[model samples]
Target: MKQITVGVDASSESRAAVRWAGAEATRRQQPLHLVHLWLTHGRTAQAIPHEEALLRAAQRLLQEAEADVRARFPGVRVTSELVTADSPDALVTTGGDPAHNDLLVLGSQGLGAVPGYLLGSVGLHTVAHAGCPVALVRGAEDPARLGDGPGPVAIGVSTRPGHEPVLEFAFSTAARYGTPLLAVHAASRHPALIGRDELEHHAAADHDAEQFHETLRPWRDRFPAVHVVEHLSHGSPARAVLDVAPGAGLLVVGRGHHAALGPRIGPVAHAAIHHALCPVVTVPHG
Candidate 1:
């Protein structure tokens, strides 16, 4: 069966990620896989100092993360593994592999030591290429804010087409927590040129509002229990999302997958992940 996977290390940030992932797995009735990755270069006649000790320590960190999750969620199946790779690229590659995981979770930052990573880089690389959704556990200091709460699930609804996955994920999350759903559409204000017609600009804004409301109709029918609020603003999408993030329990955004290679996280997703005050989940949709 597919599972929810989280990168683990010896840091409070990593532990918080595991805690968040544990509650998510329990909610979805899915297994949790705790993964720790280390780099190894082919050794010559001699060995690097404390290399063995570091490897052992990474293994212990994985074990402790697994135990912590198991203790908190006894009914959820938990597994841990320690893998070797060449560089930080391994985290992105391993996370994108569909055979091992369905969802990849990461802490906002690393332990500032060996085997620990600054997830800003990891999140940027992995979410752009991962076949599944990537969730970055960032935000308020209180862990409770992420798990169960009254805050709504805020989503950035793209004015363009092919954003069903983002909408569905946000609505389902809100329904799961029995909270409200906030759908926000951020549109740029029309430029005031030498002969620009103000009437046409207002007409365009109205059209956008209508289309955004229409898009939510099907999702509203599907998740009747979720109370969804529609919001349309004239500003940058990233800035608009950041403004509403403080009142949100989680922020859901889409990562477009169209490139044949390399990271595909667009400017909006990059901004949301880096700036949002709440935990952000990047859903991949083509």
Candidate 2:
């Protein structure tokens, strides 16, 4: 069965991620897999005293994390593994495997200089390279808030094609949680509209709204149970999505793939992961 995979460590942020992933697994009725990595630099045999001690500590941390998840969410089937490899490589390989894992959850330590910025090297690397969807949970967030709150699941809608994965994930999540799906699309102001009349501005907004509705029509049909609220705004897409994120339970954005540059998290997904108040899920799509 596909499981929800989470990276665990001794940090408070990792604990928060465990809680979030545990809650998610319970809700989805799926098993949860906790992973802890001990960087051995490929020296697994005949380790020195300090290295051996560190290995023991890593094992203990994984055990403690597993115990905590089992205690907090008894119904959730929990399993754990200790891997001796590079942190980012191990996490990406384990959690990014589409055959076994459904989602990858990671702890996010917000950049301290900025209030909500949350991309560290490991998170950035994993999110960028992971084959499956990745969810970033902040240390300060309470899992209970996500479990019990009624905040809608917000998604940054793209009119462009090839975003079916993002749409499907957002709609399914909202359906599962029984919450509204706020579909937000921000259109840049057309240069032709410079010094335009009020009537022209209104017409432009109406055009954008129609396009947004057209993009969502198929999803609305597919997820009839989900209540979708269409939100059209002007200016930066990232800023528009962030504005609604403070009140959302979860934010879903698409990770774009560049033919030349390979898989990349776009500005909107980047902003959501770094600064969204709610847990941000970046769904990969080309």
Candidate 3:
């Protein structure tokens, strides 16, 4: 069975992300893979007597978390591991993790620090290279949808053909959520003529916007429920999506295909990954 992997750090945000991941696993009837990574560096001297005990404690903690996931979602299988590493990467990728996992959930920031990171650098790296879809959730948002209503899943698409996977993923997720998907295509900017009148400027901008919509027509048809909206913005691509994310429940963005390495979406995807208010699902361009 496909799994949903969540990187847990015992922090509020990590827990929040965990709760969200657990709900999703239940929703999809998939197993939950929870990982807790401990950082350690070898010392010249002998290790402390409590070091071994600490590992056991961590395992117990993970077991408790797994129990919570099972109680909330009884039919779903849950598994966990306690790993000690000197770095963050191994804990995240699961040291050559299995490919069966369909998604990886992570906190935007860690627990309890007053000045929490909105997107840690480690999280960013996984979003870029992880084989499966990655969801970056914020701890501030409620893990349980107690008061908030679920909204449409918003997915961003470039005119690029490689974004098909992302569009499909977003549409499927929207169907599962029973929510409409708003697929957005942001128009590329053309220079406003130096001395152009107001009407000319508006005309130029409108033309580009229409082109943007035209490019998205095929996508809208394939994902029938996606109420496609084309945004004609003069600024950065990431800026356009971030500005719209606050109104959405889920945001989906695409990474460029490795074959087209020159036009890779790492920077733009990275921007949306870090700045978007809603949980962001980064899909590697297939």
Candidate 4:
């Protein structure tokens, strides 16, 4: 069966991620997998002692993480693994397989000396390339509190096509948690510019509103239990989503279509992962 997989390390952020993933697994009635990666390079015959000590340390960390998850979430079926790798690619590969994994959760750490920012290279790469949805959790968040309360789930709705996955994930999550769903779409023009031409802008906004409603119509019918609040705004999509994020418990954004060169994350997703107050999930589309 598909399981929820998370990357665990020594960082407090990683511990937070484990808690969040454990809660999600309990909610979904799915197994939880914890992965810890360690570098095994520079292990020469002469450095056998050092290598042995490093491996033992990695094993100990993995065991502790597994024990913590098991203690906190006894109902969840938990499994763990320790991989000798140079990077977090093992975790990415394991969680990116849609057939085997439902979602990949990773810890997001702030840049040194930077305030109110997160998402390092590992997060960016995983969010960009993972086939499954990815959730980035920060150290400061209280997973238990967020999981117990009914906070709005906000999603950035794009005017373009191929956002079905994003919508589906957002609606389903809201329905599952019995929380309100905020569908926000932002027009490219500024509010002032829109005001300059009242009639034209009103007509444009009306059209956009209708389009947004139509886009969500099917999802609404599919998830009638979810209470959706449509929001139409002007200016940056990233800013629009961020403005509502503080009140939301979870933020959902879409990873742009894979380019000919490679998969890439959109600006909105990048910003949300780095700065959103709540846990942010990036759903891959197209």
Candidate 5:
């Protein structure tokens, strides 16, 4: 059976992620796997005097998380695992594989002193290279707030060719939740249109309007029940999406893996992941 896997540590952020994953697994009727990585500080056998105690403490953390999830979400089948991974990359490599998990969920930041409190190194790495979609639980993560309420499931629709998976996920989520789907496309001011006449500006807006309608046609047919609202905003892509994100229940964006190394997420995705007021899901495409 497929599982909704969440990485856990001794942080409040990790506990929040567990709660979010538990609610999701219960809704989807999938098993919830709470995995904790035991990272050793040094190569030597006697790296620290309290090695045994640390290991025992980690085990207790996993057990407590599992029990809490099971109790809070009675329908969710919860399981815990203690995986020994030496590096952050190794943990992402193992847990992010789609063959092992359906959706990998992580906290915005884990238990560490790493910089960028919004997204630690592990969360950023996994989002960029994960085989499946990575969900970063953020903002008002209390278990009470995780519900199929009124707000729409929004996605930043890219005109770039390879965003089919992103659209499918967004539409399906909105359909499942019985909420509307908001598709936003930001039309950046073209360099060619610099100092152009009013007619040219109107022409650019018209062209973008046409493209937005054309792109959404097939998807509307595919998921007829999803009420989709298309918005063509005039500004930076990230700002456009962020504007509509406040009232949105969930925000979905595609990760543009166009480069060969480093900085996995594109600017828009990175901004949304860090700044969106709601939960942000990064669906890898291209």
Candidate 6:
């Protein structure tokens, strides 16, 4: 049972995130924790209110959001909180209270220049820095299909590089969703397979793709119902993953250094956050 949390800021984007979280929580039969972090200093009209009243206002906002969530996902156990400070996302993050949470969900565009709310800096910082799996959701392409529930969860692995953390999360999510897990090892540089004939070369490439798939066998065994699938794709890994992101129920990517203490995962994870159509999960590695 995955315990999921979504950061809520009373913005449309955050609400969208809450709706997505509520539905996912229902599908997983998990609790939905709606967190709101309020800062004392602000330029908003509510800034001048009595501190007690401000807190009440925040609570009311979360309660309203909770009602909406409950209306849509009656099965989801909804919890609301109003933490006073700027640590909105962090307060709800597993980094602060690791024992209670399995995942963190946030909205995209809370920082976008557009008049509408989107993923803000807090959401980005939390995703990059959270202790547990973090998901960035920006609503759905089809609101009607939100009830369609989770589908195949995609995990990106490299033929030459291993992403154990990513594999673990993907397997766990697949098992939770009762859906399939697709392991993709996308090659950034494409080197034609060695063969004199076109058909033979294509066969070699396909064989290499199968090898990539075979590498994930050990993990697939851990999750018998995981329904493992594989792909050996060429072109930019990030772009390819994003291109196929739409149909996925959830996308899982590893956030680990190619070299420990190095910074490879940050940029790739950033790209995925900004582009993926479905909720993107980033699993950090040591």
TM, every model: 0.87, 0.92, 0.82, 0.91, 0.92, 0.79
TM-score of 5: 0.92
Q: What is the lDDT of residue 18 in candidate 6?
A: 84
Candidate 1 lDDT by residue in tens digits, 1-286: 8899898877677778898889888888899988887767565545677788888889889988888888888889998888788666787666657686778888775334543333555456667778777888752346664355546889999867878888888898899888899889886565653266778777878888898888899899999999989889777888778777889878999988665654477777877776675678898886
User: Could you give candidate 2's per-residue lDDT for residues 1-286 as a string of tens digits?
Assistant: 8999998888878888999998899889999999886665656466665786887889999989999888889999999998777556787899887789899999988558777668677789889999999999888887566446446899999998899999999999999889999999998578899998989988988988999999999999999999999889786999989988987989999998999999888899988888886788999998
- For 1-286, candidate 4 gives per-residue lDDT tens digits of 8999998888988989998998889889999998886655545788776877777887898899899888988999999988676665665787777889899998888545787568766667778888999998888887567346548899999868899999999999998888999989986564565447678777777888898889999999999988889998876898988888888989999998756757888889978888886889999998
The clash count for each model shown is 0, 0, 0, 0, 0, 9
Give the backbone clash total of model 5.
0
| Weakest ten-residue segment in model 3 by summed lDDT | 110-119
Per-residue error (Å), model 5, residue 198:
1.0
- Model 4 regions more than 4 Å off: 41-49, 110-112, 143-147, 190-196
Residue 150 deviation, candidate 2, in Å?
Answer: 5.4
- Residue 232, candidate 1: C-alpha displacement in angstroms: 0.5
Tell me the deviation in Å of residue 96 in model 6.
Answer: 6.2
Best by TM-score: 2
Candidate 5 lowest-lDDT run of ten:
108-117
The lDDT of model 6 is 0.71
CA lDDT scores, all candidates in order: 0.78, 0.87, 0.72, 0.84, 0.82, 0.71
Estimate the lDDT of model 1.
Answer: 0.78
Stretches of candidate 3 above 4 Å error? 41-48, 84-87, 95-98, 110-116, 146-149, 192-207, 257-265
**Residue 168 error, candidate 6, Å:** 2.0
Task: Sort all candidates by TM-score, best to worst.
Answer: 2, 5, 4, 1, 3, 6
| Local distance difference test, candidate 2 | 0.87
Please report the candidate that would top lDDT against the real structure: 2
